[model samples]
Target: MPSRYVIVGGGIVGLATAHRILQDLPDADVTVLEKETAVGTHQTGHNSGVIHAGVYYKPGSLKALLCKAGSRSMADFCAEHGIPVKVCGKLIVATEEAELGRLRELYERSVANGLEVKLLDGPAAREFEPHVAALQAMHVASTGITDFAQVCRVLAELLVKGGAQVRLGTRVTGIRADRVLTDRGEIPYDTLVNCAGLHADRVARLAGADPQVRIVPFRGEYYELKPQRRDLVNGLIYPVPDPQFPFLGVHFTAMIDGNVHAGPNAVLAFKREGYRWRNVSIRDLAESAGYRGMWKLGRKHWRYGLDEMRRSLSPKRFAASLARLVPEVTLADLTPSGAGVRAQAIRPDGSLVDDFLIVRHGRQVHVLNAPSPAATSSLEIAKHIVAQLSA
Candidate 1:
């Protein structure tokens, strides 16, 4: 008899995993259980939709390897499925002399990751993006943009066509060694994959794995450039990210829809799905506040934390940060847009996880942390997970 596999999340990763399983093991029974009424309602849907190149990741790490391979896979998948994707590329700019060193470091990392990158002086950078202000920049040819939500939808359709089961609004409440107990009923399976994004740690515990990481939701708030000012950003314009923090800092992204997005200031959200400060959950907030990891992180970066909060609450401050990249971008040119909460995994020692974290226990595999590039690397990540199962 074919093995029965149950997937616990319906995000891009879970759907991609199901698609790969059915493609590789034709007779295997695959069922995807999602708590939301629809797929991609969380991170998959709320993200900036930038198809990342193999940039900024450590050399030879899972993120670097998967991102390089996955970007190519994603472009092919999009082309095959009639989904719209633009390889518009990106520029990492340094406005001040102090930032040049970090910019050079990122350029080196990009080269080490085997990506096609070019160093651009201020004049060269402005030649590519007329409105951009920079002393120097790294032009990454591989970076692109697409609607990941559409990708998830296409993956879901493919899974259904391939005879995989996708159960929406089905929340998994508990997990046993060989069975998954859910809100609807109990599901018996030979294998279980946890791709739960926001609550991955909780789900891992349910499956009896000590993942040793806590999911800390960091809300990234965005603003949209007014239609008339959209031309100010030709493509994506990013600052040299602070090596001390995991976030990419405030940047301008030319989304696939033609509107430009700016300023995703990172702040601690009060809830796992919290998009706004007012949307608070006592339980989620308590868990995050009570975690030793959260406290440690806060103590180390309290100043940065306060600044992020200030940007969250003040539109002028947020736009001011964006002005560092594009001097033409004024506070009046921006309108508040959507926000996404990143499911960052924090270790007990207060350090943020910098790579993808996946662990397996007998018949179960849990994805503990997969932020940023996970959506871009979904297909490759799926392949890696399937390979683990085969082993």
Candidate 2:
């Protein structure tokens, strides 16, 4: 008899993991349980769609390893599926003297991370990005853009073709090692994999596994440039970033569709899935407030949290942050865009989990936290999960 496997969450992580399992175990009966009406409706769909270049992660970390490998894998998948992607590259520009040192360090780290990068001074940087104002910059040629939602669709299609079942609109209410209870009914499975992006901790708990971390949702709001100003950014343009905050800071990104986007200010959302300021859930609010890990995080990152909240409400303030990267951008040329909520894992001591934390029980695995580079690293992450399961 084939081994029955149940996967929680229909985001990129779950779908990718299911696809990987079928690829490895040809006869495995894999069933994916998604809480939403469709796949990739949450984090995977809301992302900025930038292909990460493995520049920011520390050397030899899982994040670095996965990001580097997954980026190439994602691009390959796109090529095979007729999806278009542009490797237009990215510039980590440094406007001030103090930022120049960090820019150089990033360049070195890119080399160590096995990425193609170059360090450029003022005039040299201007040659590539004429509108950018920087004393120095690190040009990462591997960074690019693609529609991850489309990628998810392709992944689902591949899974179905491989004889795996994807159960969309079936919200998993409870999960155990051998049985998964959903809104529709119950499913019998020998193994369960939890890839619930936002509710991973809760899903693990439902499976009778105690994950000591809590997911603190951080909303990232963006601005799309006016059609006339689309030419402002040829590729991705980023700031040096503040070391205090986990965010990559407000920057400009050229989408694969030819439109330009800017200013994804990171802020804590009142609700776990809150995409708009008016959308609020009392249960979500109370759950976040009641978590001991959140209390610890609040105490540590109160200032950064407040700043992000201010930017979330005030478009003018958000525009100013984007202006720091591109001087030509103004308040009028910017318009409100979609928001993405990051499922950040918080420790009891108020420290943010900077690494990709994967917890495994006998026949189950839980992805507790996979933040920014997750989309770029989804395939490599899937391979790693398969390796873990096989081991």
Best by TM-score: 1
Give one digit per residue, the lDDT tens place, for model 1 in 257-300: 89899968899999999999998999999999999999999999
Q: Whose lDDT is greatest here? A: 1
lDDT of 2 at 207: 87
Total clashing pairs in model 1: 0
Which residues of candidate 1, in runs, are more than 4 Å off? none
lDDT of each: 0.93, 0.87
What is the C-alpha lDDT profile of model 2 across 260-281, one tens digit per residue?
Answer: 8886888778888998877788
**Model 2's TM-score against the true structure:** 0.98
In candidate 2, the residue pairs with backbone N, CA or C atoms under 3 Å apart (3 or more residues apart, or in different chains) clash, namely none
For candidate 1, list the clashing residue pairs, or say none: none
